[model samples]
Target: PRRIVAGRIESGSLIAGDEIVIMPAGKIAKIKTVESWPVTPVAGRQGAGRSVGITLDRELFIERGDIIAHASAAPRETRRLRARIFWLHDKPLAKGDQLLVRCGPKESRATVVAIEKAVDPGELSSTENKAIGRNHVGEIDISLSNPIATDPYTENPRTGRLVIEVSGRIAGGGLVLSVDAGQRAVPVDIVPVESALRLDERSARYRHNGAVVWLTGLPASGKSTLAKALERRLFTNGGSPILLDGDTLRAGLNSDLGFSAADRSENIRRLAEVATHLARNGHIAIVAAVSPAREDRATARRIADTAFREIHVATPAGVCEERDPKGHYKKARAGALASFTGIGNDYEAPQAAELVIDTSTRTVAEAADEIEQMLKTSGVLFDEVVDLAANI
Candidate 1:
């Protein structure tokens, strides 16, 4: 039997016949063969993101949750680990709650054994609580059911971080602080490897790279209207952009969701991921959603990771209620709706949005123009000649 390779090898090289060490078990074995199925066997070495099944010279004892590395430099094993985590789910996390943590091929049954403190990531202030709510940060201690290989996040982020999976979905992400003293000896950072494709290759074909323009505000704040108009503008200018409106997405991508806090956070989180994918593929993603929570918006920005701009649609609820384009606010006020933001729930106005446009004062055309100008100034629309010259 062979073991599946998780992430691609980033450092060093794995060759056939090389002595290998499996983590947590500390078992040493010889690599009999490395097979890349449905194709030729791996000749000598493999890179990241490629799938490979490794057949050990002999089965001493091994299974999943084992880290494969060269024998000379094996990963350390530890049961107790500290981490800083961002909570993304609506449910509150309390001590003694059992969960699953996964990083690459390593997964373990983990329990929240201690709650050190809760933090508001936006304000960088600590809050006292026995539990951490959705969209907050928790500095906590976790105990794994069994020892797993790990390095301090400061040392190598690939093996140092884990995703907290509640149920089957990703509920949060954690950054390992340390295995012993819980002290960061070096700066904790994930270094990105630049794409091999030249910038001109993408821009010449699509006119731009993936850029996200996020519009946040109350429901019926004319976000969709502006998004449509902006989509038209970009398309006419020989660009490709897609509009991801909240209501439209709800009817399809988010049909199971409701107006609950957790659902709301999940709604934004899913949209952010979709938008990020679209943007990375050389498409413009214009998102018009009532991402009411500040924390949710922050999560979107953090996930997008490139050319993302937040435009605050400051249309007040009173005006939106009067328009009642969808009759949502009206139903909400009549007690027909629960967990309605700007009514039962709250909409946090962005304090430092890139641009603020009030639909009551400005028409959709004007807002669209402002958004386009903002993109131009932010260099999302790069000059083709300059791009090719720099990359080539």
Candidate 2:
């Protein structure tokens, strides 16, 4: 008979004669009687930090790592553990590696089944597996060598946990969140555009053809002007283009925000979300904004997906100042407006643009003509009609 050195509840509600289950082994036993403490026959729930000893009614068998749980709320057994691993190891974790895992007072050996994907903590993007270095968070799946009594992390954090230890050194830490049902992975195969479009017939009807034109540049740099011109051209050619101008959107959608860096980033993010919605509905969205930051633009590009086309209005700052139709430059230079882009703040030009228009050298008509030509060449527009004729 193994002598089990089990501790009693110091402060909670369990009392003598209550049925209990020893975890990990799932052994049941009955509480005999209170061995210590003046049995204060309290009526209400047990208060904090009151240690009480209990004698077992049967020859109960348990161990050091075993947990005493209420019989009604006994821990469930699980073989698979899905977790978000915070990788601290210099070397990335590979599948089929065996590691010692510890959860609270319980320990077990777990084998890595799959490293689904790595995510950046700052941006939360699924980074390339080869690019996953130290200090990265990633979702992973693991299979335990032995069946362990556990719960999902959402249910119990204390019992649902794991620590990866390799060669007596802690490599990473994670929490068990889900149990995976073995399923086959789908093979990567190209899907024909026609078949894909057939899946969403309403989207095709509304959008005509899925397309998104993202126009980004410095403030007063003619991004809105170019976008409007392009929209007109697209409309004349039987294309329904949705224009999302930053200034007009800010006036309504983001009126509460200021021109701070964080606010500007948020503004771009919201715009991206809106553009995604319009594009998914099958309308060609023409986004015109002085989206000054590269990171924000990258976020927009990612959300826009395959339909995204970045159009850079490469208007010079001096030229923009000269045409400052809103007098924003004078106000910014006079210190009346703070955090004004181009004058007092930074504006990152598009490193890669599908179409770059220098408004200084090109007129609005010429810019519009270039966009129409691009649409025709790209098969987005089928008609050879000029801008005026297309409008009719």
Candidate 3:
């Protein structure tokens, strides 16, 4: 059977051969033909406000409320939203209330997450109230059980306006302000803006290419000390640098993760993302992490690509245990810490690190100096005068 989708074009023109995405479900199909009732002379194209029937190149089970949009500009799919609504029910709209949301042709169950502000429509006065009185306007946060295809009301009035229904009766109406809290657009078409400053220009200014200096080893192996020393030295040379200490990250960004192998891998992956972002923006990102697994380090290297420098702080397990600043080695020795690298767990040493420093023998400053020289030799740190002359 031939499936025909009939609708009015709300905002944009649609024509035959135009590729379209069905929202919420995120299905992609091309328009095979555009049809008008009574066979108008316009064969291929139809503009906004015109009623039309479109046939797809492929079959899809599209619901009556499904939205069709250009593949380049698909609507957001989110379970959360922020909106401004006017209350019409005799009862006040409060947080934790469950209601039906009707936007365009789609309807879904929604819960009021929060009432940010309530304003009396008659007096035009605002209050920090927990509920919105009848005939009052309220800015609210809503959570949905299922994802919905929507746009901000300021962007598209036709698709952004919604009504709240209680027991199948209209109780309120609102405009979607934004898709809030962890919602992303379907079709994954987000484009990143390129920085106006070029890498070469940044290098000429800093005399150094942005880089991720990853120091990986067992616990208490002097990775953090060496990383901090290197960061200080780089900054002293007028280079932009940031230290990403493992303990600090675990205490904050990666705090939710546990000590499981999967969590450790995820930790490294996230660190790589952050470090690579800094490196791309022309900062020396000094990372000090145990990063016990070789595969995780490889993944980090892959993420940083040419900007990665793996330095293994090769202090032996016995020496690291003796110098355990946090008493982690003591805990491991007492069987209080499971999966402790170089004790309960294994620490996979890097086979092809850019530099190997046995911190048990060398002083912290000497190790920093050796690593700095390696960076200079690898062209990561360029001489300022030479770089300026080359740019000329």
Candidate 1 local lDDT, 1-392, one digit each (tens): 35544335645667689887777666677777777767746687776656567677664535556677777777667777888899998898998786777766676657788989999878889987799889999888887754678877888787888899876688999898878554322211222355676555766766766788899888878888888899999888778899999888999999987765456766887899899877877788999998987867877887786668899999987888788778777788799977777784477899889899999997788888888888888878754544555555
In candidate 3, position 328 carries an lDDT of 90
**For candidate 3, lDDT tens digit of each residue in 116-234?**
99999788888899999888999999877556799898888888999998866999999999986535575742235668887877887788999999999999999999998888888
Preferred candidate (lDDT higher): 1 or 3: 3
TM-score, structure 2 vs. true = 0.48
Full ranking by TM-score: 3, 1, 2
Put down candidate 2 lDDT per residue, 152-244, tens digits, no spaces: 677767667778887669999987777554221122222223334431353333324556788887778888888888788767756678999
Where is model 3 poorest over a 10-residue stretch in terms of lDDT? 182-191
Off by over 4 Å in 3: 1-185, 386-392
- What TM-score, over all chains together, does every model reach? 0.54, 0.48, 0.54
Clashes of 2: 3
Clashing pairs in 3: none
Off by over 4 Å in 1: 1-199, 383-392
lDDT of each: 0.77, 0.70, 0.86
